[model samples]
Target: MLAQLTNVSLSFPDKKVLQDVSFTVYPGDRISLVGPNGAGKTSLFKILTGRLNPDAGAVSRAGGVRIGHLEQDLSDSASGHELTCMEAALEPFAGLIRLEKRLEEIAVKLGREGHASVLMEELGEAQRRFEDSGGYSFRARTEATLTGLGLPESLWDREVSGLSAGQRMRLALARILLEEHDLVLFDEPTNHLDVPAREWLEGHLKNSKVAYMVASHDRRFLDAVSEKVAHLDRANLSLYTGDYTAFRGQVERAEEEGWRRYEKSRKQERKLRRQAQDYRAWSEAGERAKRGAADKGFVSHRAAKVMKRSLVARRRMEEAAENARAEKPFEGDEIKIGFGPSRGRGLIRAEDLTIGYSPERPLAAGISFDLSAGERLAVTGPNGSGKTALLRTVLGEVQPLSGGAGVSPTARVGYFDQDHRLPARDVTALEILRGTGDETLARTVLGRMGVRRETVSKPASRLSSGERAKVLLTRLVLGDNDLLVLDEPTNHLDIETQDVLLGALEGFPGGVLFVSHDRHFVDALATKTLRLGIT
Candidate 1:
């Protein structure tokens, strides 16, 4: 075992976040930590890294283990554009390079067979070391990782500072893989990644020999990369052997089996209780018939003891039945979402659109596509395929360049960006509704989405990100535009929430366009996927 967490518990005052979380990280273990949002997954990682102390319990490291963490947003960590991904990866090889150069210089001036042999040996060792550091093959590996992460080759030369938050995160993930470490932890590793990037990461993780723990909301990614899953719930950690898919199956089966076991044991206990009840009733009748005043108290007391012992046994049996029962997650029966037919008539058109950051060198050009009403189009490609940009243009967030345009008016479009608009901001949720004249109806809508009445009246701005997203989604429905465009809508939502959103989209009759890394959501909701690739 590389690391073992024994009776690890954490709490903040009255709220116990984690309770007795015990697990082992072995040499080849790839574990995924999962739970409802705010279940203290991040807290656990902090505890592991010594950033946070557990309220109780202890985490012990076995041997001298090298632990590496891929920190959030690493673009600036590299600090310069002079170093490419390959160069950044090979920083360790700089020392080896210097040693080899000195040895070669000394060997050139001395001409002895022994010295030459020694030189050759050292040179060979250095070369091997460099190769192992991924020096000669570093370019290919870096390029593959970068490309796999949906970054354009052109980005290889771009300043790390120029990258967006998501881009920086991808670069960080790539670099983490480049390093050799005994154990690695990834927190929300797939947050800004695309489908292809996610798949590539999954493949790398599957073939990896190192121990890793990933905190992620992407079920497909978890299913692909993890060999074991850890669920944090009710202040307890439960480990399930196998990937997410296997875990889900196992859990479902366990619940079914639990119900059976509970029923079986419960029935047996009931039978015993009935028999005991009958015996007591007969004993009482005998006492009444024999009513010698002297026998009354003694007989009554003996029979009462018998009844008490039987009841105790019955109580213990019921407790055992309860212990045997399984509590499984309850996926909602359905989430109602309605979208009207898009006002976009026969055609949705982009004419000769040249899109990008600057007018001097636009990202993509001559982009034109028509998505008509009733067409569920999916924009897809590598990470930098300008998918989000295209959606924005469709929504008129970005104006078309010279000689380019989206013919449809902005009013006809509704967009849900990759960064979901709904973040619990400080504004009272009531204000959020009142601002849009949706106050009177807010409670009903929120209740439908699983928000309680008490929760609805509070400020949405004070809510968690997921809660805010829920509120914004309600607004999107209120917007009631014809065309629906979404960007990475599934980013932070858990498996169950993702399912609810999927059900909503699948039933939506309006023209829909959304970009997501989730293959399951894509397959279920998309009518036709548009291949958006950057040159």
Candidate 2:
């Protein structure tokens, strides 16, 4: 086994994150870890990587196993602040890098006609080690990986700190792939990847010998790359030997069977309860008779014995009923999102609109679209294709470089930014939701979105990414606008929450416009699509 966790358990003071979770990862195992927003998938990854210790049980790993963890955070201190993109990508092969530099230095020395027999021998040994370590074409491998991950040669000389989050994530992924560890851990690795990049990564991983465990919400990625699905639900890790679709089917079947058995148990318990109640009534009547007959020279021994036996039987039946496990059926909660009444049609209209930061360099131009009342328009394109700029222009957050993009005078647009920049980080979720002027409604919306009651009072910035998403969505739902503009609405949400959001979007009466790369989400909600091209 590459790594194994046996009967692990972890809990905080207020919540039990994981309980008795066990799973084993073997060499070349491609496992996808899936769960709800607040499930302990990340915690499990930490445990596997030895970042956190389990409260109970043990984690074992094969000796000398090398693990590469691609975390969500791209600001890696180990890569150093001054390193260029190429240098950082090749950080794992520092030995080879040094060898290459030394060989160059020896070449310069030999060119000077110096008597350097020892230097020549040293150079020969370094060359042997370099060849043995697959260093003969390491630069080619690095370039190939970077290109495959969508980071081209033009980005190689740039400072790592200068790259955007998406670029940084790609570069980090490229670095990890080039490093070629025995096992790799990826947490939402597809978050910033475009469709092409995701496809490339899937193909690369499929052909690789490296074992990888990925925690991802992208169903397509999971289905494409996973050979096994590790579902983390209710603090238990259940392994299903198939892709995500197959695992989903298995879960559905199991849930149905569980409910069926639970119902059967409940029926048995009801029967026992009825019998117990009858015996209790008989015992009570016997007691009354015994008391009444006390003055009539005493009760019969048979009657007394019958009364005692009846009481004992009733007690046993009650015990059996209490011991039976008849859990309630599982009915998931859903967020209630209803847009307010629409004032008029043509909520948003863009005519030959050119949107960008500057007039000289428009990201896209000659774009025309109209969104009517109750219509859903999806804006899709590769990264940096003016999708977000178009949304901002329609929202009047940015001025159009040319042409015109206008919203109806009567329509009220509620915009959800992809970054989820809250108005104030210090404010609690309840406070933010209450910004809409209804505390009870705010709490209800939050609850329906699966935000815990206790967490509502915590600072919005302090919540998990998913919880923060729910908070933003709650605010949007409560806004009661005639038009809703959402940007990557499902970025951090789990599948269940995504489904709820999708249903809300479909049912919403107001006009909708969204910018997203999630094909599934777009397919489910978009009535019309606008495909933008790169400038």
Candidate 3:
């Protein structure tokens, strides 16, 4: 095993993140660690990476093991160290640098007059060592990793600090993959990657020799790369052998079996209790007989014995029922998201729309579509393909550089930005929900979304991403908007919550337009698709 966690537990002031979690990662093991938004997958990752010591139990690593963690914080990467992109990526192979220096030294020595033979021998030996140590291939490997991760060769010599946040994260991922680590921990590694980049990464990870554990909400990616799944739910880790789909099947079967056993035990207990009552009645009848018979002592003894046996049988049945009770299946919170009825037939229309900062360099052009009431339209394209720009154009958040876009005068458009940008004002969940002017309805919606009563009073800034998402959706749903425009709505939601949102979208009565990379989600809810930048 490369790393093993035994009975690991962690807790904070307010919540118990993990309890008695244990798992082992072997060489080349592909593990997908999954759970709800607050289910402690991140905490477990911290424990595995030694960033935080577990409150209880042990974490062991093989001797000389090297671990790489793709953390969310890109500020601490090579950019922070003031290194160029190429330099940072190739930094892992210091031996290659040393080998090159030695080769140069030998060349300088060979230039001298008398010691040609000796220098030649030394040069051959160094070259052999370099080749054996992968010195010759390191540069190619680094370049390939950078390119595969969507960082072009043009950016290789550029300063890392000049890159955007997403670019910096991609650079970090490239550098980590270039290094030879025994194991890697990836937390939401696909967050900034486009579809093509994500596909490239999936292929790269599948063929790599290093063990890895990824915590991602992308089910397709999980299904693609994971050989084993480690599900962290209710403070416990359940390891399953197989891909995500198989694990889901296993869980469903297990839940069904548990329910079946529980119901059977309940029925058996009920039958036994009824029989015990009948025995009690019979014993009472015997007591009555004893009161009327001449042999009162014998009759009383029989009645007492019968009563004791009946009580004992009932206790045994109750004990059996208690022992047979199964643990409640984990049914995560549901987020019912939908829109109010649209006012007009043509909710949105874009005619020859060109969206970009300038007309000279448009991200996408000639985009024309119309969304009618009760229709669902999906916008899809690669990164930088103007998907978001197009959506912004339709919503009037951004002016189209060419052509035109329009919404009906009577239609109320609800927009959800990809970055989760809510109102600038600091407010609690309750305050945001109160925008509907119905406190009871707001509370009911929040409760249905699984926002705790106590948490409703807390500031939105204090809530987790999932909680904030719920609050935002509640606001949108309660706003009674006729048309809903969502961008990557299921990005941070747990699987259960995603399902809930999907069901709601599938049944929504109004027009819907959304941008999402989740293929399954798109397939489930999209009635029409607009493919951008795919000519």
Candidate 4:
């Protein structure tokens, strides 16, 4: 094993986050850590990366093993903030580049008559070091990695600090790969990647010789990239030597066994109950025989003693049956979610409109199109291709095509954006909801989405990300909206919550136009998809 975690336990004050969880990372372990929100997936990664200490247990690594982690981690502070993706990736070899330049400077200085020969010889040694480290070819390798991740050549020179979240994340991955550590840990590596870019990343990871562990809910991604799947369930961890599909099959089988055992136990308990009833009948018969003897004037001590002993025996049998019944188990299947009332108008019509930040790159031009209501369209294309821009345009937050756009006037819209910037941060949840008019009605709506009364009183900033999402979605639910435009809305939500949202949306009456890279979610929700691209 390249790394081993043994009997690890971690806690926060009164809460035990992880207990006796252990797993191994071998030389070729391409594992995915998957679980619902609050499952300690991120916390586990922090411990593995040494940012946090476990309350108990020890972690050991093979001698001389080198590990590299992706750029998204909070603990990874680099000295190249001023550099671009290409430059940042090549910064590790900056020392060699400096040495190369110094060697040249020394050579030039040595050309003077007074320069020492010893200095010139030292320059030769420096040159050798630079050459051996591939000093001259580092830039090419860095550019290649960036390009493979879908970062355009033009972006190679842009300041990293000026890049968007997606671009920055892509750069981070490039830096990790260029570092060439023996093991690489990717924490939510697909956060900002588009579908194709994500695919490219999977290809690179699969081809890499370095070992890695990726924590993600993307089943297709895990299947595409990993040879081993490490599952986190019920606070227990287990590893399977196969792709995600196979591992999922294994889990299903285990759950099936649980179901069978549960049923068997239930049946046994029922049988014991029946046996106890029969024993009661037998005891009553003994009493009846004693009563009959007494009525006939034959009530002897021996008869009475025999009746009492038989009753005692019956009671013992009943106790045994009760014990067996106590061992019976009660288990229920995972909840099944289904939506009602799926029928709706067939189109979300938009009139002639132009959309863009500048005329040079209008997201959509004279965009006259209509999506059948309930049609699931995926607005896609390269970075800055305007998928999100189109979403904003439809939501009326941004300028539309010169002629303007329309949503059939009667079409109500439900918008879910990544930033959730629709509301102010300082306002209490109740105030925001009441902004729709009717404070009492707002509270009733918030409750359905899992937001409590106290949370409604707190400012939006005080609420958790999930809670914030709940608030926005709750508003959408309460409103009589007919069109839902979500902008990477699934970014921070757990799979189960996503499924919950999916359940609510599956048969929703309105049209859904959301931007996302979650294939499973799209598959589950999108009845028809729209692809965005340049004409």
TM-score, one value per model: 0.76, 0.89, 0.91, 0.82
lDDT of 2 by residue, 38-76 (tens): 788888988999999999999999999998898887655
- Distance from true location, Cα of 305 in model 3, Å: 3.9
* Highest-lDDT candidate: 2
Task: Estimate the overall C-alpha local distance difference test score of candidate 4.
Answer: 0.72
Residue-level lDDT of model 3, residues 77-96, one tens digit each, is: 65354788898888888778
Residue 453, model 2, lDDT: 92
Cα error, residue 417 of model 4, in Å, equals 1.5
Candidate 1 lDDT by residue in tens digits, 383-447: 66688777777666787664455635643556666555654456666566655454556555555
Find the candidate with the highest TM-score and give its number: 3
Quantify how close model 4 is to the true structure by its C-alpha RMSD in Å. 4.7
Which ranges of candidate 1 are over 4 A from the true structure? 73-87, 92-94, 100-144, 150-153, 259-375, 401-413, 419-426, 433-467, 477-481
Predicted structure 4, TM vs. truth: 0.82
Candidate ranking under TM-score, highest first, comes to 3, 2, 4, 1
Comparing 1 and 3 on lDDT, the stronger one = 3
Query: In order, what lDDT does every prediction score?
Result: 0.71, 0.85, 0.82, 0.72
Stretches off by above 4 angstroms in model 3 are 78-81, 108-115, 286-302, 324-327, 332-340, 436-453, 464-466
TM-score of predicted structure 3: 0.91
Backbone clash numbers for all candidates listed: 8, 0, 0, 11
